[model samples]
Target: MESLANLECFVRSAETGSFSAAARLLALTPAAVSRNVAMLERNLGVRLFQRSTRKLSLTETGEHFLASIGGNLHALQAAIGAVTTERGEPAGVLRVSLSPSFGIGQILPLMPQWLARYPLIRPDWQFENRPVDLIAEGFDAAIGGGFALTPGVVSRTLAPAHLIAVASPAYLAGRPLPRQPEDLAGLDNIVLRASRTGRVRQTVLRNAAGLESAVQLNESMIFNDPVAMREAALLGLGVALLVVPDALPWLERGELVRLLPDWYVDLGVISLYYPSRTLMPAKTRAFIDFITEHFEREALARRFRAGPG
Candidate 1:
């Protein structure tokens, strides 16, 4: 508990950039904050902050230590809250970030029941194609693909990020059908350019037999957002390689047809990401458990696994 107090003081000092500011935030005296930090430095045998007349800032070691233990401090606080509260009925605004199509198509549908189950929990969600800084943005959780596992962030696999080629029947009316992976060259293609890299990415398609082949589309059209790319394909513009979960509704209704039915690309895993805390907030933990259980009950992960149908 003493060590925990020292850590809490250090984290607060690091965040606010001074012992006085940390003292104000933690409701302690500036001298006490300084003493706690000094004790921590002695125990760890490393100077955490470089002190100056104008300001104080974390040393290189201090920066790394903060990144590593920041989440655990939060978890410790949350655990204390969980046990201390009288009812502890998970009351809070549950802020989440996720992709548009999947959030709308898959996650959005699950919300009504979830809300009913935990009415005290208010939903605050953002839908985007690109990743956001989960901690900096003050998000409780995020769901998507290709997010770097930075310090204090953890993820649980929700579903496979599988990409399959699709086009409206009108677009392929007179165009050559893609019988093989290479046959996509003969058809009009809608490419997805990485917003960060500004490069049209290549996709590796795999079949049931475990054979893999990479395909590069000749860009008849390019889109930065996955939802827009799928919409373009649905508008009869061209064949677009889209994640299966995003296209499931359209595919099920016969509005979009899968080109090369036996082939799909392994983009990665669609995951639920949250802070890697020693103990999570009740609201965040509840949401995580609910979503995980829902995914299992529906077998959505198995349905979305990469490769042949």
Candidate 2:
């Protein structure tokens, strides 16, 4: 068990590239994680990490050992979780990745109730707008849309991750509304720089009747996050494209109005993504089931429909 502890510390540190990051994931102090890995090095009579101020890199032995054991770590965790939760109650840290706009606006609100219901499971969620390498980064689950489902990972649809052009009433006080996708070429677009690629992503607009068109938007301002884009539109800076879920509140409050009521960018469904079902940890499984049920009960997916946009 002591060897197991050391291996866990070493593996997490390797995956995260630094002791501090591993500590956050493990819910331990950086010093404690560093000490554990050092102890393991002493026991094995070899340095596992080549440490420097900027980052931690794996030594040869560390790389070999990690390759040998990393694949089995989940199985070991699942076995322990099975015993710890033999009574059918899920317990353990449940780490998840989420985008801030939806995480803060929608999911965060339901967390109190979720925590109450699953008192044993600890939520360690990361709020970010970029795509995450779930298996490599050791995230239990992630939420978003348009991510390619790699082998050994799976997803469950939550709601449409559709995008539509919007502008504040003040911004469009006298401006002609865009009646078609191509009309958007004439409006000033607040665009998003893709987090993963560092490029402006192409927007494909779809109509209610399923017709599609691409737009080469005229950029007025550019943002890296959806929240910022939403704010720009709200401030009457320019027309911005936003996901339905993120823009729902503003639409309801009449702070922003959707343009081209029939056109939307089908970015695909936002989903709860996780590792394979086989050998899944109890905490993750519990979260998946809980979130699914919550969505159904609240009819949350329908709310993302947001009256055409």
Give me the candidate number with maximum lDDT.
1
- What lDDT does the true structure give each of the candidates? 0.82, 0.81
Q: What does candidate 2's lDDT look like per residue over 136-222, in tens digits?
A: 456788987766676456889988777878899999998988777888888889999998889998988877666789899998788
Among these predicted structures, which one has the highest TM-score?
Answer: 1
Could you give candidate 1's per-residue lDDT for residues 51-133 as a string of tens digits?
A: 99998988999999999988788676755435323565786777899888888988999988998988888899998878976
> TM-score of each candidate?
0.75, 0.73
Candidates in order: C-alpha RMSD to true structure: 8.8, 8.2
Stretches > 4 Å off in candidate 2 = 1-78, 83-88, 306-309
How badly does each model clash, as a count of residue pairs? 0, 0
